[model samples]
Target: MPKMKSHSGTKKRFRRTGTGKLMRGKAFKSHILTKKSTKRKRGFRQETVISNADKRVVSTRLAGR
Candidate 1:
């Protein structure tokens, strides 16, 4: 059987943690920085784990990652 092609965009935007959870960057920090507070911007710097409900779909595209 041929190898499956992982989603290129997903591969770049998300990653699987050592524990197998889907890790992705937080949103709302990329624009309008002047209106956002320092604390809020700091929070966006950290990666967030994907919610359980969305795990199945993400896992499929990230298979073999």
Candidate 2:
């Protein structure tokens, strides 16, 4: 049987933590920073766990990893 390949885009966007949870970057911090508050911008710097609904899908894409 051929080896299963992981999703390239998913691998770049998500990472597994020490405990195995998938961590992803918060969105909306990439452009038009002038209108966003400092607090909101600061929050975007932290990585957040994928939601329960999306966990299965994301993990499957990352199965080969």
Candidate 3:
């Protein structure tokens, strides 16, 4: 059987946690941040787990990793 390739885009955007959850970065921090408060911007620095609804789909894309 042929080897399954992980989704390149998803692979770059998400990471596997120690417990196997998918960790991803928050959005809206890349552009025009002058109006956004420092507190909100700081929150974006931390990683977040993917939603339960998307877990299965993302896991499949992540393959072995």
lDDT of 1 by residue, 15-63 (tens): 9878887999998988899999999899999999988998988898888
Worst 10 residues of 2 by lDDT: 56-65
Instruction: Estimate TM-scores for all models.
Output: 0.89, 0.94, 0.91
Give per-residue CA lDDT, model 2, range 1-65, as digits (tens).
89999999999999999999999999999999999999999999999999999999899999974
Q: Residue 58's C-alpha lDDT in candidate 1?
A: 87
The CA lDDT of each predicted structure is 0.88, 0.95, 0.91
Better of 2 and 3 by lDDT: 2
The lDDT, on a scale of 0 to 1, for candidate 3 is 0.91
What shift in Å separates residue 21 of candidate 1 from its native position after superposition?
1.2
The alpha-carbon deviation from the true structure for residue 45 of candidate 1, after best TM-score superposition, in angstroms, is: 0.2
Worst 10 residues of 1 by lDDT: 56-65
Tell me, by TM-score, which candidate is best: 2
Off by over 4 Å in 2: none
TM-score leaderboard ranking: 2, 3, 1
Q: Model 3: which residue pairs collide? A: none
List, residue by residue over 1-65, the lDDT tens digit for candidate 3. Answer: 77888999988999998887899999999999999999999999999999999999998888944
Residue 54 displacement (Å), model 2:
0.5
